[model samples]
Each structure stands twice: as structure tokens, then as C-alpha cells.
Target chain A: MATSADHAAPAILNEVNPPELPRAVLVENNRSFTWITDKICGIIEGKTPAWWWVCFIVACFVASFTVAGITYLVATGVGVWGHANPVNWAWDIVNFVFWIGIGHAGTLISAILCLLRQKWRTSINRAAEAMTIFAVVCAGIFPVFHVGRVWFAWYLFPIPNSNYVWQNFRSPLEWDVFAVSTYGTVSVLFWYVGLIPDLATLRDRFMAAGNKLRATIYGFFAMGWRGSNRHWSNYEMAYLILAGISTPLVLSVHTIVSFDFAVSLIPGWHTTIFPPYFVAGAIFSGFGMVLTLMLPLRAIYKLEDLITQYHIDCMCKITLATGTMVGYAYAMEFFIAWYGANPYEGFAFINRAFGPYAWAYWTMITCNVITPQFFWFKKVRQNTALVWILSIFVNVGMWFERFVIIVTSLARDFLPSSWGYYSPSIVEIFTFFGTFGVFSVLFLLFIRFLPIMPMAELKAVTPQADVHGGENHH
Target chain B: MAAQPHGLIATFETAPEVYHAAEKVRDAGYKFWDCITPFPIHGLDKAMGVKRSNVPKFSLTGGIIGFCTGMSMIWFMNAFDYPLVVGGKPYFSPMFAFPVSYELTILFCAFATIGGMFFLNRLPMHYHPVLKHDTIHRGMDDQFFIVIETRDPKFDAARTRALLEKAGGKDIKELEA
Candidate 1:
């Protein structure tokens, strides 16, 4: 039997120029197998950080405004939102699209990256998936109340009822109910299925420390996972199938959401480019949100070894790519509008860039198009503070993109008399801020209670944990 | 069958060593044996002589049902129940039905996969004999283990321990049922 050293010498010598494998480290500083579990599980087991409590409390306080705003809106009616004759789909719809777009990154990381065999996603996928679930929740809240009678939201589903009034199958609104709900349900199951092994790890850790209650709680979720080969076989297969299912589902979700506008006869809204354009924008905003959350998290948790520079760099590249795609879509929308020679469509394009809401149009251009181009330089991508700040710019820019799309198109339609400037009421502004609070509270609790990083998955990617090969001494 | 007093547990430092031992145990004709590890060690199923999972088949079945349901619901609601033309398009257009059908297919498939996993694993069985073993905790950490049940036909305690030790297993123990 040839020793590994003996085999390595010939392979190294045989190649004319062995491609220099990209020097990026997946897990930095050669972390040990036990170190992976300890560092990750330690976050859950160890004392709560003071900053976490501060963030959580602040998030909850801000989230209270959402409750108050919703209460007032329900009491006073949708008229409180500044929705008038033409600009009726202001702030609420824009926020809905923005949040739903934010969720795409999570599914993109977990399902799409998993299928593509991108090992780096293992570090961030769990948290990203959790973010998807919470973001969808925030997104779902808007359209439900946008109907004015929130209680009658159940009518959105195609249930057999005594009223005998069936939902329009051709309506994009009906498709949205299915798309958003299905996306939410699948995201949760994927997150939980991935969490089971790590939950078992937590169960054992808590049990060892004589914390019976915590053990019981974790154990219940773990579903008595004994790591049997039989169970693992099914688990892996199920995970793969889910990844397969979710990849297209994620794309479809945003596409269906896009159809809510694109299917309409409105000049700016009706375009063939909306699906790909929306999907790219969704990924762009999603990565921005990931960067916003992860940069601070990596600093706070001191998880530089696990969530390394390479992960951040890869994410930056993705943001750049998706941002470029979004920019292309923006350009294409204008180009097609002009080339098609339709006066309403051509006017819509001109109005967007130079009309009443031109400020928002330019903001979207600066933040989404211009800011991310800075990432083409390695220096900008590697700079954590710059990346984090730029991510916030992308977030703001994406919100504006939706704003420009919804309000500008509606504010000035076919009839000149209905044309009016629209601005969000205080209630609408508060509700939007409140969603940020809702997302933060869920995220803070998630980081505190659950294994934020998938401990088992992180371990699987390390050299020492490889099953086929012997441990790499390096 | 009555609960056994003890079953043999063998611990290995690495996944490959335990995987080999699992293969050895399977080749030795042990029926009631299983391996445990911190994570799912790749190719462990082949080593344990386990068959491929049928979860995908169940998912497909679910997807077919969902497709049928989606098509039927849309057609019945729009065309048959009470047709109301808004855009002068066909009431039961397949193109219009595609989105709802796609969503339902994914929804049903996801539910089926999860359900199949749970059913196959006989899960939510909170109490297991292996859970009681002291060294079982390490299975969730860094250690790899193979346990042969007392209920197995070839379960002579002394011989089973000797076989495990020969296969490079460490810290072999008699776990109480």
C-alpha cells in the first residue's frame, strides 16, 4: 500500500502547472472539530451578551409602533395611509415587495447554494434561512392589512365556502397568497430539518450540565436523532429533495410577486423583463441584508475563524453581480420603453427619471447601481465597515426601487386629472419602521436561543471531519 | 421481547474507523446494530448495508396529487362554478393555472418529504436505550460509535465486545436498556 506522502509526490510532479487553488480559506486558522461545536454551542450555553439584550429591547420598543399603527389603521380605515385616487398603492405595497425581496437571499443561500455544492454557504445558510422566514412574516403583514379588513384575509385562500364566490384564478393577487404562504412554510421546514442535528448537540450539552428542562426542550425538537445510518440516509435525501424543490420555488416566489404588478396594463408595470429583473433585485437586496446582519454578528461573536474573510468576499461578489443585473434591468426597462414607441410607456420612463418622484428614481440608481460597483475593487469588498455601510445603502436603494415602481407609475396614469403627488402618512412610516423591529426581535431571540450557525454543518466542511480521507494534519 | 440488561457500545475517534467497524459488524451478520456520530458521515449507509431512502417517491406521489387538486380547483372554480370574464381570456386557461399548480406541487412535496422522514425514522420516540448510555453524549460531539443491540441473534456479549475491539473500537461498554 502506497503511503499518502508517496502518492502526493508523483501527483505534484506529474502536473505541468497545477492550477494554484484559490488561496481562500473556508474556515480560517485551522479550527479543530471540537472547537467548531464549542464556539457555536457556546453562544447558546454561555452568558447573554449585554449588546444583545439592548438590541432586543430596542427592537421590541420599535415593534410596538407596528401594533399601534395597525390598530389605528384598522380603526380609522385605509384612508389613514394617504392612499388617494391614483397613488393608492403607496408605501404599503412598496414595503411588502422590499421585505419579500429581502427573503430571497436566505433561500438562495440554503437551497440554491446547497445544490450548486458551494460549501461556504454552510456557515451562513442557517441564519439566512431564519431571516427568510421572519422577512416573509413581515412581508405577509402588509398585503393582509392592505385589503382594509384584515380579518377577511382568509378569503384569499381558495376554500370551499357557503358564499360560493370563487377567487379569480387569473389574478396575480391569488397567486401571491399561494406563493408567499408556500415560501414561508417550505423555508421553516428546511430551517428546522437542518437544525435537528444541532438541536441534538444542544440536547446532549444541556443534559450533561444537569439542565433537565433545557435538555427536554432540545430533545423534543431533535426527534430522538441517534445519528443512525438509516435515519441519516433519509435525512440527507430529504434535505437534497428540499434543496431541489426550494431553488425553483424561491425564484417563482419573487416572480409571482412581480406578476402582481407586471400582469397589469400599467405602462411601466407591464413588461416582459419583470420576472428576471425582480429575481435579480431580490437576490441583490437579500445579500445586502445578509451583509448587514452578518458583519456585526461576526464582530460580536468573534467568529472570524468560522465565518471568515472568504465568505464575506464571496457574498460581496454576489452582491456586485446581482446589483449589476438589477442595473441592467433598470436600463433595459428604459430602453424597451423608448424603443417600443408607446407614448404612455415612453412617458412613464421619462417621468420616472425627471418627474415628481425623480428623487427616488435617482436614489435607487445611486444606492443600487452606483454603490455596489465599488465592490469591483478588492479593497472595498474586504473592508467590513465599508461593506456594512454599502449594504445599508443597497437596502435603502431597494426600498426606493419598489417605491419608484409602485408610486411613480400610479401617481400619474392615463388620466391627467387623477395625477397627484403622494407621500406616506406618519402611520405608514411607523408601520414600516415597526417591521424592522419585528425582524430584529425575531433575529435577536433566534441568535440567543437557537444555534445561530449550523454547528453540525460547519464541522462537516472542516478537513479533520472528512469521512473518506484520514484527518489532514495541517 | 423483554428489555435486555445491556448492549455493547463501541467508540471510535474518527468517522472512517467507525464506518469500517459498521461494515465489519454487518458482514458478521449482526441484524440489530447501528452507528452514531456527531454528523452524517458520508457513505455510511453503504458501510451499514442500508438501502436507499424512498422519501422522493412519496414526494412525487404528493406532487401528483397536488397537481391534480390544483388543476381541478382552478378549472371548477373559474369555468364551472361561476364564470366571470374580466379580461376576455378563457375561463380555464392552463397557462393561468400553472402558478397555483406550481405552488401546490412544492407545498405538497415539502410536506411529504418531512412526513416520510419522520415516519421512516419512527421519530419523536423520546426514550431510547442508546440515549441512556453515558458515552452516547459524545456521539453528538466529536466521537463516532457503533452499538449492537442485545436483541440481535448473534448477540453473545463477550464475543461481540471482542469483535468490536478487533475492529479498532475504543472504550467498549455494556449499555443498560
Candidate 2:
């Protein structure tokens, strides 16, 4: 059945002899460092308009001004913001909890899914990890800044002093300090470790002759990786171990954060369901953030083939699940408020839904409870335009959810004399804006420096990759 | 330096061809050859008569050690070193210990899975005789090929070439150690 044409050795290589170079192929036309960098420079200089960069800058501007407002509030007094006798905690606390909640999906995707060996993760994990780090950075900034005397924030930690007083480890706030700091450190490390291999690949692909200095710098960060089997062996092992470590941390960190509220005997704050409820909310908001970024990202990077419709579909499913969980938590809170027969608890839920801040309540329910249900339709989930719009709505909804919870319950308490409506002052507003700016700047830089997708991981999952088969495939 | 198996390296265009050839070779009573490919071809393991790997057993052992260590540490710390009533709850409450215990189990199990997988596969290794054979690199790309080691007792250069041709191999070539 075979002709000599089939029998003859191919021109590329004789059947008996092959080239020594690894099977690296050029992914795009004009595969040179100079060419790639020039293209990137062109994008920056408006030889090509990086629309995402423009939107990112606009977001940064808005976020920066809000942060400025926060700085002003800190300088003046907590009184400048919406704080009265009983409702001392307001927008600052709400935003603090909201941003922290928004950081969860990143950890879930990068750490949990990595352990699960979900191949689809290759497309988004890098960006998601970057998002995690930035979101956490944003989250960490709030708690520290919200306190009036930001300088003495270090007092939160337990350090030995002449007074011979030790920190009360029993306090949930103390637990929060430890949990958030540990979570941030581990998240950063997890992200950076995963970036090493991909960064090295970029260095090899893009390092220039004259730019050897920059190349060496990026290369050093890349850790002298040569993709040896010995390296991959240890690298993969370490990654798995880190993932294992992060999973419980993901669940615990938010739980401890929730304890900051749940431990208090305030009518609204005290609840057994706070821990799991907060986690579900955090994940729900976090997915909303991911969706906000994913749509434009795939287009900007020309990664439609890599990111695909499948990823968007999967993320929509998660958003819906977590959104429902959060909705359930809301219902459970209302039920417990009634069942406990605690007058203060009953008033807290009643006022939240029907009080002066009822608009925030309605907004939260509409955005979080009603909006995500649209994703149940396969067409809605797969439609990039619709997904993008809904994701934005989810973000606003999640933020409002926190706003409603913090303000409504605290503003109108059992003692009507102490009850007062609260609103964010100018300072509080600026600080929130500035944090968003910082997050955007960091993310834009990451996409430019690193391969937006994990190419090595992608290569591994490809059907033609050796490791996909049994280990002994010759 | 080693006694050579005089045999041809055969490349198949698809996975099924490799499977069929491996099956035929097993039926012909050749135990001195092995097939390698770019990807794991399903059912090729049975066709090649390769035994199941012991990676799972290693991971299980590792997981057990991790779980025990994790639980013991938490018990010793909360029950032994510092016993303070937490929220008026009893010491050694399983709920309080879950985080640390779960962490340990995961730590151990993951370590075992990765370590065992590598060890069982004899990996993290730098040397391979096939690396010297030029065409072997393609095994990671588009083609599937099998080699008869030089040390195999049935190796004969001319007869092996004829056998591979009869087995429907196209463009067979001699492989060197």
C-alpha cells in the first residue's frame, strides 16, 4: 500500500537523524525579540491603541480620586465620614470587607484548580493570580487606612514592650491580622512561583542583544530555569504543596475576616452563618471581577483561540453558584432574625430592607440575586457582550451588598436615639478610587511583561505533548 | 559498549497503528522492544504488555504520614502546651482543629502524589540513551516510534528490517546506542 514517496525520508529530517534543538516553534510571524518589543512599544505609543490601557487609566483616575477622599477623611477625623453615636463603622468598613471578598476567586482559581489539574486553567491562571495579588493589596490597604491614626496601625500586632502587656490572642481582630498577612504573603509567593517558568520563556523569546541588562534582570527573576526534567519534577511538587497549603487558607482567611464582624455582639454583626456566608460572597464578587477583566483581555491579547468560549462558560457557572449561595445566606439571616426572637435582630433585618438605606438593599438584591440568574441561559453565558455587562452589574451588586449590610444594620439600631443615617465623606471616597488606580497599573504592567497565558502549561496539555500519554511513551 | 540489538525504529502516523503493531509484536513473542510517542496513546499500555505503575501506593503512604503528623501537632499544642478556654468551649474541639488537620492531610497527600509519580517513573533524570538518537526528539511532537534495545537477545539488523517492513512500517531506520 505504500509508495517510495511514503518510504523516502522526509526533507525536514531523516528518519534516522533529527535536529538537536527542542521542538520550539514560532507562535507568531517575525519571531524576534526586537520585533516583538517594537510591536509592544507600538501598542504603547498609539501606533496601536491599547483600548484596555485607556479604560484601565480611566478606572485608575476614578479610583485615585476616591483614595484621595479617604486620605482627607483620615486627616480630618472619622467624624468627617458618615459616623454617629452607634453607627461608628460605615463606608470604610464596608469597602474593606468588599475588597477582601473580591480577592477570593483568584486564590480559588490559581491554587484550588491547580491541584484539581483542570487543564482549562492554563488560559487564565496567570492573569487571575496577578488579580489576586492586586486585589489583596487593595484589600489590605483599607483596614490599615480606615483607622484614624494610620501611623499607630502597628499597634494591631503583638510586640513586647516595657508595659509587659501581651496582645489578646482571643480577639478576632488579632486573628484577622495574622490571617490576612499570611494569606497575602502566600498568595504573592504562589503567583510569583508560577510566573518563573513563563517569565524565563519570555526572556528567551524577547531578550535583545543590547538590552542584555534588562534581559539579565528578568532572567534572574526567572531563576535560571532550563526546563530540565529534574527541575519540572521539583517545580511541580512544590506547586502542589503550595496549592494544598492555600486551600484551607482560602476558607480560613475569609472566615477569620468575617469573625471581625461576627464576633461583635452588634445586632447585625453577630451571626453563626457569617463565616461561610462571607466566603460565598467573596467568591461571588471575585468571579465578577474576573469576568470584568476576561472579556476585553482575550480580545486585546489575541488569545481567543487560547481562552475560548469554554472558559467564559465555566466562570459564569461559578458566578451563578456562588451568587445563589450568597442569596441563600441572606435568606438564612432573615430567618434567624425572626426565629431567634431577639428584638434587636428583628429590627436589624427589617430596617435593612425597609429603612432609610433601603435603596442599597434593593440594589444588592437586584444585582446579586436577580441579575446572575441570566447566566443560567447558555446563550447569555457564552455571549461576550452580555457576559461583560452582567459582570459589571455583579461588581456593583456585590459592593452594594456590603454597603447595605454595614450601614443599614449599624445606622438604625434598637435604641432609636442613637440611630443615625450615614454617608461616605469626600475623603473616604478618594481613597477607594486610588486603590483601584494602583490595581489597574499593576495588572497592565503584568500583561506586558509576562506571557498573559501560561504557554508551557498549555504546551503540556496539548494532545501532542509527551507527558499527556503514559510516562514511558518513547 | 553494550551488546546491541540490531533492529529498525518504526514510526506510525497514528496512535492506532502503534497499538496494532505492539499487539502483533507481542503475539510474535518479542519482549525486547518498547514504544514511545508524543502523547499517551490510550490502550497502548495493554497492547505493549506494560505493567501498571506503583505511583498510587506511594501517594497513599505519603498521605497517611501527613495526616497523622498534622493531627498530633494540633493536639499537642492546644491540649498540652496551652490550654485556655476558647469561647467557653472545650479544648481539642474537632471544629477548632479542622483547619490545621486539613492542611496537614493535603500537604502530605500532595507531596506523596508528586514524589511517588516522579520516583515511580524514574524521572527528574538527566540521562537517556534515546536522546543520542536524532529522530527520538520527534517523539514529543507528531510521530510515534518504538525501539528494540541493543541488549535485547533477538536483535538482528537485516532480519529486523525485514520484519518491520512486513509489519507495515514505513521508512524504518537503524537506531544507535
Candidate 3:
């Protein structure tokens, strides 16, 4: 338990381009390496708090709603949803898109940030990546169940079957199946690979503490990792390649998701701008979610030093940048509709903002557009309370954005006979709400059983880790 | 009877100590040696004379197979195996096949990358003489360690220990894994 100050030997001055520019210490308080390990591992090894029990219990209860809703849907059929002739997509599609969009932020932090060399991502990437996996899990439920029969959802894959029915390669829905599944699988590999070093540390700690059961479990996964440099040589390359592939993969996933609409004939959904717009919106909402989840956990764990306000500021700025892009996309959509002179298309955009679903459209505009603008002010970004509340708005707005796009177009299709207002059935509402519970339950378990932060990765960022760094090289 | 003396291990307090120690070991002509640390110390690979990993080769091979699989799978199914038409379009078009191919490429590439890493690292080894060292866990924590194996041609108990001591390594110990 030696303090960092024990060997202070004047802080190592990092070499910079301008020679002596200052940078924020990624880990605050000059915390020692042992402190970092003890702090992170403490969460899992320490007694499970009462509040965790309450939260876990509630999450399970909430998750049951999904289980119940799916069971009923299977028994009664897809008719249990409020989907009708024209608005067949309805909340199922909306909720699916919503959950999928949330998954992007995790990959963005892990892959995109790693590629960009954003060092601060180390503190939050583990949790964000976990969120990505669980969000995808929640997202997978909607489309699978919406296919009218959950059992036949396997049909989405290109596996051989008795009927020899192949998926329609031409259909965007088919592309979505490939894109999402690939995204989910790669994300798990990336997440698990990142966990190995930290897992080995936990295994060693458990063994030292005489917790053979936990140690054996963690050790099996650690794969006899002794932190050997030879192993690290390959491990680092694998990580870099994963990040490289994932960067393109994350962008492609949402673009393909957007293709589900853009490739369609629906006026609002069919836009050349959907790809970049959807990607931007996904990043925007994803950062909002990262903020939402991190703020609470940071507070609860007292991880202020690791998370730091600098990280918060950086996150807020990205949200602002992406949020602005989304707003621009919204405006451009209208401009394209007007400028193109397609009456149906023009009518669709006009109907979206001024039609029956105007409430949802306006709500989206306020939450997605106006909410992020607050981040422009340093006051807002720095205020944890304000940032948390606004992060919720960002997610709410993104959900509505999907809903507005789906519902408004279908609610007033080309024929008046087919036109009808869309609303969710109680089952649909609960099913969508239940996903949050499902996500929370998985996330809670992850925190309880695993290292929520990448300890080894974080240690790498500290100045002390630099061999040529600091005055005390010895 | 003495557990066959697997190798000599030495502890260093910091990355710099290990980095320099690795250089000394490399210069001293040890081949079956490695530096174990809590994390990858930047530039330690160069110090240890380690080359870039060959994981990308496996990743590329997997990607190529995946792409061919996606392309041929669709061509065989829609164009050859079943032979049906839906949207009055050609039976096979790479334009439409690109997404699935691209996804499969990434999927298989990832699988290969992870699999290659594990295969190359000889992981899940479960037992190693190094793990027998009571204080070896420290290598996965804050401390840095250099272990020159008994298998190394240059390995000699007295000489290796002296070389490590000269490189600023402390608490040098000889143990069998």
C-alpha cells in the first residue's frame, strides 16, 4: 500500500511538440497503480450493497414484462401490437431503431475513440462497450419477435434449412439482419478481448485472497495470461485490428439500419440523406446515453478522479457536434422535399411537422436539437444535474425522431382508405419499456461480476507508465 | 529434485527499469526470455527486439474466405441452387451482395484475429512453471518482471542472475514453473 507520493522523485515531464505544454492527467491525484487496482476490484469483491439488491430485484421484475409480453404475443399473435394495415411498422420498428441507435455509442467509444487515440475513453469504454452488447441484446428482441414467429427468426440467417429458403439479399431487411448480428458478434469479441488483462488481475487477486472458486473461474478465462510481452505483442495487434474493423463496422451498421427506410418507397423514410443523418443521430443519442449511465455510476462509485470533468466536457462536446448534425439533417430533409417538387414527399414532410403526429415531431425537435445546444454553454456541460437531465432528453428525442419518421409516413399513405393514426398497444408499450429493465439487469450483473473499467488500459495512460517519462526513470 | 530450475526471474519497480533490463537481456543474447508487466509498456517491444505480430495474416485469410463465402453462397442459392426471381432483377448482383459480404468479412476477420491471437500466444496453457512462483501475480499488477528461461542457450544460473542485477532488477530468484 505504498502511496504515489512515496517515490515522488519530481514528476516526469512529458515531451511534447511545443516542449512544455501542460496536459490534464488522465488519472487524477497521481494515484498509484495499486490504488487503481484496489479501487476497481473493490466493487466486485466488496459486500454487495443493499441498493444493488433493490435495483437488481426491480430490474428483474421489469424484465419479466418483456418475458410476459413475448409469451402473450406468441400465444395471441402479432395482433397484440397496435399495428394495422398502413402503420404496420409502428412502435415495433421505432423501438427497434431506438435500441439499435443506443448500441452505436459503445462501439464509438471503444473502436472510434481508440482509433482517434482519445486516451480518456479508457475510463468509460468498458461500461460503454457493455452497454453496446446489452443494448444490442435488447434491440434483437423487437425484430425477432416482430417477425410474427420468434422461432422462425433463425430464417434471418443464411443457414441451410429443410425448405432451402434463402434470405432476400436485395432486401434492406436482410442486410439489417447481417449488419446487426455482425455488429453484436464483433462487439462481444472486442469487449471480451479487452477484458482478458483485467480478468487475469482479478484471477490473481482472488487466488491471493484464497477465493479459489472465483479465482478458478476467472483463471479459466484469463487463459494463463502472465502479462508476458510476447503475448502482448499479438494481443495489442489484435486489439488494433479489432478497432480498425469496428470503426468501419459501426458506421456501416447504422447506415444499413437507415437503408431499411431509405431503400423504401415511403416518402419520409426514403431519402438519400438517411445514411449520414442516421449515423449522426446514433452517435448523438449514444453519447447522451454514455453520459446518462456514467454520471450515476461515477457518483455512486466515487470515481470522480478516473472519470474526471475533462472526460465529461469531451463527451458533451461530441454530443453537441452530433446533435447539430442531426438538426441539420432534419432541416435538409424538409428542404429536399420542398426543392425536389415531389408532392407526396413534400406532403410527407409537411405532415410530419404539421400533421397528426406533430406532437411527436416537435417533441423530437425540442429534445434532440434544443437539448444539445445547452452543451454549448460551459455551465451546462459542467453541471452534472443538468447534463443528466438533458441526456435523457436526447434519448427521448431520438426515439421520437424514429417514431415520427415511421408513423407519419404510414399514417397517411398515398390512399385515404389506407390512412390511419398509429398508437401502441399496452403490450407494445410494456415491451419497449421492458427493454430498459433487461438492459439494466444485464448491466447490473456485469458490474457485480466483472471489472467495469479496464484497469490495465487505464494504467497505460498514466504518465508513470511511459518509460521515458518523468525525471525519476529508475 | 530442486524442481529443475525453470528460469531466473527479477522484479523491477517501474517500466523504465524493465525497459532497460530487457535491452540488457537482449544484448546479453538471451532468446527464450520475456518481460511481464501489469500493462504493455510503450516501446518495450523494440527494447525486447520483438517483431510485429502475424495476426493480420490470419485476419486477411478469414476475410477473403468470408467474402467468397458470401458471394458464392448468394450466387449458388439465388442464381444456381434454387433459381428464382422476385423484383425483376438479375439473379446475382455484387451490388446487392456487398452488404452481406462486407458483414461476413468483418465477422470472420474478427473471429480470425481473436483465434489467431490465442493460437499464437499458446493461451489456455493452464499450467506454467512461472505461475509456481509465489510472487508472480505481482507481474500482473504494478510490478515488472523479466524471466529468462532455462531453455535459452545462453541461460546459466550465475551469469543470468548477474546480468539481471546489472540491469537494475531487484529480488532476483531462480524457480521452475
TM-score for each of the candidates: 0.96, 0.70, 0.96
All candidates in order of TM-score, best leading: 3, 1, 2
lDDT (10s digit) by residue, model 1, range A138-164: 998899999999888888988877788
Model 1: TM-score for chain B: 0.92
DockQ of every candidate: 0.78, 0.05, 0.81
DockQ-based class of model 3: high
Q: Stretches of candidate 2 above 4 Å error?
A: A1-63, A70-80, A207-210, A466-474, B1-177
DockQ of 3: 0.81
Error of 2 at A370 (Å): 0.6
RMSD each, Å: 3.0, 11.1, 5.4
For model 3, state the Cα shift of residue A148 in Å: 1.2
Q: Candidate 2: what is its chain A TM-score?
A: 0.86
Query: Which residue ranges in model 3 land beyond 4 Å of their true spot?
Result: A1-21, A470-474, B1-3
| DockQ sort, best first | 3, 1, 2
The clash tally of candidate 3 reads 5
